[model samples]
Target: MIVNRRGWMGLGAALGLPVLGSHAAAAAAPRQGQMVHHVFFWLKEPGRAGDREKLIAGLKTLRAIPEIRELRVGVPAPTEQRSVVDSSYHVSELMVFDTVADQARYQDHPVHKRFVETCGDLWARVVVYDSIDV
Candidate 1:
């Protein structure tokens, strides 16, 4: 069965897996940070292939930024029915950072700024989800 974050935290703690916002987080966050960034872009013109390609290309340029440990960009998966899944977004990016600081730096980096400036106009809505690894 699917479990939510609280349930995951309980399971993680029991299994000695990392849990964010616990005592360990307060004491000293692991130097190898566990910040995850999830971004979904909904295009104003979702029917247009050009908009999708442009955003994909722009996001690829973001891979050159040094702070991100891992970066993945793609469209939604054709998963089976689920209650909480959201697949309406045109483009999605999943980025993992070593720390919150590194993520913050990425937000202000010139290349990131350029990506926004260049491709921001193509989307009708943008949703971002940021989380610490637990």
Candidate 2:
């Protein structure tokens, strides 16, 4: 319920992957009864400016969905190295919703649909992990 990307990646690294995933965040932490939607993307070309820009802009569109309680999209950090810090992903998207129903609504939201249509081709692979606050 309180895992960050670093923690997730650490698990993945131990098993060998980029994630082992999102939870709905509270105003303070992840434990105020929220769901998490976490995504990791491996791009076709991470160095391409056009791809990065398109993906970044597309991710912003998800914020428009009213169901999202919290959202954060960003490139991997240049963090101090450890086996768990898998930096292979081009970008990571983390979101928290008030409930599973809200996350489900976000899945079908029109803005989300548009983002996939516009930029889905840019990524070679995507990994998603979702969790419910229990």
Candidate 3:
């Protein structure tokens, strides 16, 4: 008997193989969470000099928010490798959340917004990356 595409798909499904565009596979896939990290460079201002206190205070305020699973702010340590000496950015901030929705909420949070509004002007460039853990 000749097996068509539909027959092959049904056989695969019966054998518990994932079928493309199937609701079962979609439902079985794991849900991923979000992690947001930023590297900031302050050109006009000194390294962690101007607005440092206020920026730390704002970061602390963000830490107090429940949506933030993890928050860290620091400067990169010098590495021995010559190629690793690119110190263009002075500071970095990393924040992780349980879900993308939590990150969105954190963005809208008063403390986070205040932090950006307060210290954003000091930075010449800010790079942000958001990813989900597998």
Please give the lDDT score at residue 52 for candidate 1: 96
TM-score-sorted candidate list, best first: 2, 1, 3
TM-score, cand. 2: 0.75
lDDT of 3 by residue, 1-45 (tens): 999999999999999997875687878554564555554554446
Clashing pairs in 1: 20-134, 33-98
TM-score of each: 0.74, 0.75, 0.64
Selected candidate, larger lDDT, 1 vs 3: 1
Ranking by lDDT: 1, 2, 3
Rate residue 38 of model 1 by lDDT: 95
Per-residue lDDT for 113 in model 3? 80
Error of 2 at 23 (Å): 22
- Choose the strongest candidate by TM-score: 2
Q: What are the lDDT scores of the predictions, listed in order?
A: 0.91, 0.85, 0.71
Question: Model 3's lDDT to the true fold?
Answer: 0.71
In model 2, which range of ten residues has the least summed lDDT? 18-27
